[model samples]
Structures are given as C-alpha cells and as structure tokens.
Target: MSEPAEDPQELAALRNEIDEVEREVVRTVDLGPRAVVIAAAVFVLIVGLVLPWMGGANGLEVLLGQHEAVGKASWVPRLFATTSIGFGVLGSALAIITRRWALTWVCALGGWFASVDGVLAIWSRQSSAGPGASAPGIGLIIAEIATVVIASLWFRTAWSRS
Candidate 1:
C-alpha cells in the first residue's frame, strides 16, 4: 500500500517560519561603518603583537614567557597581553563575523577591560624600569591605543543600535 502524503499547508507554514528566523538572524548583525572601523583597530592590535613589547622581545614572546624580560616582567603586562589577544583579537573577530548585537556588547565591555589592563601594563613597565627591567616598548603602546579605539567604536555601535 502507498504511504499517506504530508499536509501541504503544514509544510508551507514550517518553511515560512524557517525563513522568518533566517531573516531575523541576518537583521541582528551589524554590517555598517562602525563594524569596519572596529575591525581595522583589531588589525592594528594584531600587528602590535609582532612588534617589540618588552626588552627586545615581541608581544608574542612576552605572552609566552619565553623572553629574557619575562623573568622580570610583572603580572600586569602579561595580563594585558592575554586580554588583548582574548578580547581585542578573538572577541572582536567573533563579533564581526557573527554580526550579533549581543556579541557586540560583550566585545565592547571586554575591550574596555582590556584597555584598563593595557594602562596598568604600561604603568608597571615604567615603574619597574631598572638596570635589567625594560620600559614599555612601541608595540605595547600601539596595542593600548588600538584597544581603546576598538572599545570606543564598539561602545558607539552598541549605543546606537535600537
């Protein structure tokens, strides 16, 4: 015997519901100029990673604790590196890719927190400067600036969204 056919009306309703969800998802993403600016700042933060941060070591080396400066480096600078990578790089990337408003808020808050970490990192480096200790390098400064920019842009974007 042949199986009964599915209800066409029910199938059409399900398809319509799926389409509405897809549209809603697309609508929640922020693909405007602010997002582009935030992405650019994140790029700068990434570039800062490869530049000199502590002593002669790059940001990555300092983060990995593989440099000579690592022995004398304070916890603040290390924490700054970790947050920069976590929120500045990874969180921003996820927010941009997902285009979700909630993610944007999360990234914005994380960026602000990272910016604080950056300031503390710089202060730690300056205060600890001695014969063996190194001052904050150009890369660290750049990363701090980038983090601030990202945080500001994300804040503006989140605020403007309805």
Candidate 2:
C-alpha cells in the first residue's frame, strides 16, 4: 500500500508539540525518584480542585462563584480545599529540588496542617442528620489524601536526612 504524502506544515506542528511535551516532562523530573511521587500527588491535588468538593458544584465552581466566604470558620475547609494544592506543588517541588532543610520543614509542617484541614473539611460537610447532607465529594477526599501523603513523605525525608 502506498503511504499518503505528509504535509510539511502539519509535520512541523506535530514536531513542535512533541518538543513542548518533552520539555514539560523534563522539568518534572528534577527530583529523581521523589519527583515521580511528588508529581503524581500534585497532579491529584490539582485535579481535585476541579472536582466536586461538596454541595452541587465542584471546587472551582464554589471558589469562582457564590462562595460562602464569610465567618472565620468558613475559611477552614476553603483554605485547605484550595491552598493545599498550591503548597503541595510549590513546597514539594522546591524542597525536593533544592534539598534545603529549611524548605523541607516548611513543606512538612505546612503539609501536615493542610492535611488536618482537609480531614476537617470532610467532617464539616458530613450530614449528622443522614441523607440530608450533600456529603463530601471525591475531589476534597482525594486532595486530603494527597496532602497526607505529601506530608508523610516530606516528613520521612526530613527525618532520614536529620
């Protein structure tokens, strides 16, 4: 069978796309073995941000739209349900790549606090009255789990090094 002739313009575009993907992956590989796990955790956390945190809408929906942004207590879940991803990604990436002790503790402590917030977030959304509550969604749960793992990992790494 004769192969169809490839268009030069299309070929060039595809090549560029491939190169861009390669560069992105390379950036994620800076921490060696730790990089893989950290990247997965970060990916999970980010994805969770877009998923249903509770209520009828997903996290982005709540954050972007009519957020219940009142009361000091409201900030508990809201902060963890969002900033955990930011800290997880930024803290883990920097701590791992830089191998600095200060950053390690910062990530470990921050992650631990965030993990607790995640758990409480789930608790706050639960229905004591049964069947009536919206119940926690996968996104908040996944983010919570990832943050726990990230905290544990950073803590373990810090312990071993010390």
Candidate that would win on TM-score: 1
Tens digits of per-residue lDDT, candidate 2, 47-118, equal 887877766556665445444432233455677755685568788878777666667778889999898888
Write one digit per residue (lDDT tens) for candidate 1, span 1-162.
Answer: 998987999989999999999878755765678777888898999998888988888888888888877775567888889999998899889888888888878888999999999999999888895676888899999999999999888888778765
Superposed Cα deviation of residue 48, candidate 1 (Å): 1.1
The reply for model 1, stretches above 4 Å from the true place, is 1-27
List candidate 2 stretches off by more than 4 Å.
1-31, 63-73, 127-133
Backbone Cα, N, C clashes tallied per candidate = 0, 0
Which TM-score value belongs to model 2? 0.67
User: What TM-score, to 2 decimals, does candidate 1 have?
Assistant: 0.83
Q: Which candidate ranks first by lDDT, i.e. highest?
A: 1
TM for every model, in the order presented, reads 0.83, 0.67
What local distance difference test score does each model get? 0.86, 0.72
